[model samples]
Target: MTMRQHAVSDDFLRPDSINAFTDALRGAKYNVDAVLERLGEAGQEGLTRNQTMPALDRLGDATDAQADLIRLFPLQQIVPRSRLAAFLDVPALIEAGVLGAIGREGIHADIDVRPYGFTDAAGEWSGWVAADPIPGMDSIVTRTRPNYVLGVSPASTSLAQLTVPDRVGSALDLGAGCGVQSLHLARHADTVTLTDINPRALDMARLTLALNGLDLDVRAGSFYEPVAHDSFDLIVTNPPYVMSPPTDAADRLVYREGGFAGDGLVRHVVREGASHLA
Candidate 1:
């Protein structure tokens, strides 16, 4: 089978693979800079600070240039394309050499085929594509739909940062999402249970925890159903608190809607959580 076929068979879009891709793109950014500098030496007006700075930003991930490079290059040429781009930005990163071969049978094949595109408010060219996945993250929610609980939101990070560490017996992470809070709690707790109604989110939580080298108990069930009653020393939940009507009830997925109106889920979790706590 062809490399593309092999990649498709394997799901290579894991977090690590994304990181590698991003690193290569960063290398490309340096190459681009050198070219711009040479252009300045030749009195070709060089890249304007404004034009050039954005290209540097584009090297990170999911930008127009990265996407275009992915689409333009042959399958076998991806790593080299990435390296060439990297060499353009930072010559030092390319000293070890560009990738000569990509393992066809990898888990993140779809990421290679998927195109990353972006548009600004005035619809100007945002010439950048993500060459790597965000560390510890898989997919980002780009669309705002009703019943869609925002994942990795600032609020979740805030709560995670504010969490008080304790040498607890057990902890429960309700609506774990990406498992950020659960992973945080794992530092101090003996065991952490990450629960989420969305299986996809749960999968990501598992990956995130494992990536961090923490062995966590990942369960998929509606809030509180997966755990034994009164089993946890502490329970932390960032429930679906959006007050808007769901775009589709089936799409509620428990991440956005609490199934109760107006902080009902939060209140229920608070009330029920008291019972679940040891």
Candidate 2:
């Protein structure tokens, strides 16, 4: 797709754009049933674990002629938000049995859900809190702070942007939250290993890669645990650096806490990374 075809202005999230996107999805067969299933699943769970590309790919596989039709739809083009939310909302509506499909007139239902901005790291994105029970995972709603450390922060993006691009080499991204750095590095790196201490973050990173059509190895473990020594030409980490109070152990989310006092996490990573670098 051309830049203009995919590019949406800052105001792209307006009601009109959403209506257009809904109409486009409703017109496609794969979008109708599959998107509904996804949204329904999301309502039961806070998020969807399955990636979006496979469903789109399955649409193509189901019918040869529809493959090109799916390509032309460009759901991402109408609104540059995370595909996970889009996929989840559709299924949520379908599962509720409130709408047969996302017709233009039915767009109001989405607005009612109050899809507001959740994080603004690499791109503008929004998330909706499901009122219904989240499937499989615990139903506990995670309370988030300003989270100077959660999601994709500026430090992570800066490392990614500053890294040399358009080169082929194996790269390792330690603590790859949301996979922003890994995704940018993928522009030049042949392969990327995204390691994270939190499985939820790895899950989000996988969704990010899927949305962008980029592939990376998503492993759940502490820094460098999933990777071999002397295997990476480039290793990058934007670790948890915030200092928390001694009594407020609950304040430290897995993505934000280093399990050490002061800059101990950073120091440890630097020392350990030296041994792993190729």
The CA lDDT at 146 in model 2 is 20
lDDT tens digits by residue: candidate 2, 1-278: 11211112213333544444344433443342343453344332323432335445444433332233232222111221233234435444333321234343232121112111322234543222111111122333444532222444457657766676546588888988666777666656788888987655665565445434455787878777777554778888888767652446655656667678887888888898887877
Query: In model 2, which regions exceed 4 Å deviation?
Result: 1-89, 92-142, 145-149, 228-230, 244-249
What's the TM-score of every candidate structure? 0.53, 0.50
Model 1, range 138-181, lDDT digits (tens) per residue? 12335433323233555776786566666788999988876667
Prediction 2 global C-alpha lDDT: 0.49
Per model, state how many residue pairs clash.
31, 10
Model 1: residue 103 alpha-carbon error in angstroms = 16
